[model samples]
Target chain A: MADYKNNTIPGLIGFFLLTYGLFFPSLSAEWVSFIIDRLQESMEIMDSGQLLIASFAYISRNALLYFLIYFSTLLIVSALTKNTDSIAFSFLFISATLTAVFLINEFYGESSSYAPHFFSLGLLLALNSYITKQRYYYLTFAVILFFLITAMQCLNLIPLLSQWSFGADDLAISLKTADSFITEDQLFTALYFVLFAIFFLIAVIFALLVHLFNIQITTLKRFQVQEKELKETRFALTESKVYEEIHSLVHDLKTPLVTVRGLISLIAMKYEKTEDKKLQDYLTRVDHSIDKMNEMISEILYENTKKEIDVDEFLRYVISHLVLDDQKIRLEMEVQENLPYIHVNKIRFARAIANLLENAIISFEGKAGFIQIDVKKVNDTVRFQIRDNGPGIKEELMQEIWKEGFSTKDSSGLGLSFVKRVVENHQGTIFVSSTPGSHTQMDIYLPVSSGQGGAFYDIDHR
Target chain B: MKKSSAVIGCFLAGLLLAASPFARPDSAASINSYPNLPAPIGEETILFTSAGQAPENLLLAKMAEDLHLEGDYRPRALASDLYDYRTLVIIVGNSPYGLQYRNKTFTEESDRIKQLLNEAELREVPVIILHVAGTKRQDNQTVELIETTAPYADYFLGLKSISSSTKIIESMDAANVPVTLVQDLEDLHTPLNSAFR
Candidate 1:
């Protein structure tokens, strides 16, 4: 977007400058006349030095006027239209008319000449350019018009040069022989025509050059966007490959870990009456470690593919499983009735919510705790807020809680980080606020429109 | 009823007859008036650029040349030898730049033109006054030159833009000098041809 804006201003300026350049000769003539009128009051005679200075001043004054007009018009019209093409066309049409009038008035005042012929031809080309849809055709037409006008001016010199070669008497005789003749008038008219035509041709070339530069800028911007997208695709591909290897290694260990848990449960049931406090404590610790490992493996294997999920059903399933595992923690749920369907990866979102519930239950350390979960629609977002009345998180730790490999008390540092990843994968945001001794509230917001969701994840992983 | 119709017919005829003299042909429109001056011969017509050596003299000289008159325009103030020319053409307009080139003041240029016109009068060389292109240098000297010399001109040729004002035309009319107003500089050829013939 920044690149788009950056190129448009130059395009408008180039168009205006070209128009101004084409009309510079006539404007310069006016400047010279104005300066001479002002100077005549103060000085009776103009020395050669003064004359040279005045001539240069005449050209400078015209250039200054052209800049002032072009810049101001560009600014005002650009502000009004905002679209580059609109501003350019408006400036082009106005400038073309002004240039035509200036040329016509300068060349022949109420006299017949070849100027009108070239003027009409140039105007027609410009009009045709307006009708053409392709930008290149428009530019080509403009170039041809400027070149033709210049050619006409150059051609006018042929008759003039012939008359110049003759001596005054021969010229007079030749002029006399001609049926329709204008002597000195034609000379001055043709001279001004050539002058203005050259000015316009130079202007056209400058405009074309600026236009080409604008095109380069636009092309560079597109290239940059493509380069960024290519980098992202490569990174995603590398990450997916690494995850595939890790998932296979962890899958083999999952079977052995499940068999060990089954054998421990069978032995514990057989020796149910044996009262060994140290032995039971050690067994419980082992059970917790195995559960943490399984949870880590499950998080690693999680993939977030977008699909419409019923908020109430997903939350009820998550709460039922969490309640069974931690019977001491009482779960109070408030789900808004007639809840809107949410588009997301249901498994990833449920994991995020379950992580928050587990964190709330752990904060009690086996003491009875109240974990409240609320879900409701807010504006264009579906919001879920989980609150715990256990000893809340410290303010200093809150900032560091979501960092990867940074955990308060964990065997692996993947718990909160995994939760953050799942929430983000569903294009939802999670934030927590706590008053250290009172309570912690973890709020998650997901946009109703799931444009940010990774919809093609299933195809990529498969 | 017949008598009334006859009266209306006579009134309409009177209106057309009155309009006929004012309705000039396209060729004659450029000629304001042509005085009864003799046709200029090749050897007797001399063109003088007065007051500032303005371009008007060269332009009118071209016109005269095209009319087959054998005289080139000259920037001359000393009209003492004017007796050789039968028709004297003085192109008068004051340009400060032209005066600066000659190192002369407007008063000096105006005096020289008055003196030259007096010389032409003394030599009995009929004068044709041309007020052709430009209104830029219509300083006091230009107006003075017109007032002082136009009365003596046998014929006056002016472009429409230059002579649209009745001031100079009225003065020449009082002097019984013929005046011609050309719509454009190109229109001057017809009256000039007639004058040369």
Candidate 2:
């Protein structure tokens, strides 16, 4: 697990250059022996220890020559480009040029059998990139390219080579031998076969290594993502605990307020026909204020409890409460027939709808306006569009509508924001679109119930 | 890099000169090694046994097949009757240890081979003589057989040690026949193919 990312392209090139310097000598020597024997058309050159030594010396010199060139190139590239991608581009250019030169020389009888080495070099380059970026696809691409190059080189073996002058007698014998096979070119044939075997083995090993490595990397990445998600969820859970305490406190306050409202009602009912009618009117206002407070408190406490309810019944209940409070605004509701039960907090959902209706009523500003609530089952979810024909919100204020404590009118700006929060808590979404003087539409979506047991509300169920 | 390459090049050139006597540019001909082997005389060839009993004629035929040479191997046929053959291959050795010729005695076989060589010489068919049986065939009788038949051959292909004897070497030199000496029995195909070619 050394970090290849920190390794620069020039350094990688230098490393490969060092590798070539160490290993290419033997390969080059073998190639030289093959070339000498092929030219002689006899094994005399191969048998002569002197020729082998000369070949080894010659190949080593050449290897030394190229290695120095590459090493200097690496040094220059690293010095100039440093850790930049330009070095990779330059190195690839150099490698491609070198590979082409070597291959041409191999085919032209200066040498033979550099393909497997080039293949290995290419695999190393690709593997370097893959390891640095942890991108398995790069390795996959390299493997494919390696096979393609090998196959192409194998096909190149089909042609007869530019042969050696093996005396006239050796040439005649070689030609006779050549007549029986597809190509009389034994050198090309031998080189490609050996190269293919070596490359094939290398490809299999590299593929296995890449495959296993990719699987490990993918699994590791997936685990890291899941761990991050778990951490975020745990943090959110801790934060939600604070809201639960506040909701409990609000729930507790409702009991005393209800008792106080009952006492105020008794006082107002006893003095209904009294001369002090002002007191009676004030008590009635207090009762109405208490009722609003209770509704707000119930909305706050409406967390984590859900029940399956008929869509039509739920819409009717919300509409009944709205119509009783304001008979001036015309309220219209349309529910699709045979709609499935939705799993959600009925009270909270109703409060959210009620808030929308209240906003629509206030938009009318005592002038008659129409509010339409449309409910239907679409796919696996229930959709509700609450549209109002009041003076629509300006486009400038639209984006700010969902912001907490943001309002265009004189009031506490928590109603629409709270509605959005409640809708989101039920795994649902609400969208709004409006045009000035035309209409404003609020569309809400909630997932339909799967008929599993939920935290049922007795009042809603009954 | 340039300096290192120069130093390495000088060292390698020095090593090359030190290791090979023929490393001199003018000695290029020495590197080609024994350039006077017989040229191939087209595909019309026949592998004819001189001693008549060397069962290796079949083996040489298989070798011909392996070398991709188109030829017929007839151990008992008269060379004069082979009008279509361009070349005659005479295997000049006797098989021992239950592998000898049953049809003729050593004298009869040698006479028959002498007749075959005369017929081949008259017909102007190039003859390739192979003394591949090594030391086993260099007995006094076999030497006599070789002396009679080998001087008629255009090429002498055999083991180096077997051909190194003063008599055969002198005979080869006198006949102006080029000798291609192989190391072992299986190595005969190189020289064989060279003769056929």
Best by TM-score: 1
Clashes of each: 2, 2
What C-alpha lDDT, on a 0 to 100 scale, does residue A152 get in candidate 2? 32
RMSD of each: 16.3, 20.3
TM-score for chain B of each model, two decimals: 0.72, 0.72
What C-alpha lDDT, on a 0 to 100 scale, does residue B184 get in candidate 1? 59
Candidate 2 residue lDDT tens string, A229-285: 786676567657856788778889988998998899788878877988778779889
lDDT of 2 at A451: 38
- In model 1, the Cα lDDT at residue A413 comes to 50
Clashing pairs in 1: B32-B180, B33-B179
Residue-wise C-alpha lDDT for candidate 1, range A1-462, written one tens digit per residue? 885565566556656665565565445554544444433321223133333343234434533543333343434344445543443444443454345435533542211122333343334333333323334543544444444444333333333322222111111121221211343335434543566567566655555565566578679989999997786677567767866887798788899999988987886776677798777877788888888677656755656546677888888768766754645777788989888888866556676788788878878889887888899988777889898888987766766676555666764455677777777776777777788778888877877787643311110000
Model 2: DockQ vs. true structure:
0.03
Structural similarity to truth (TM-score) of each candidate: 0.42, 0.34
Candidate 1 chain A worst ten-residue window by lDDT = A453-462
Docking outcome class, model 1 = incorrect
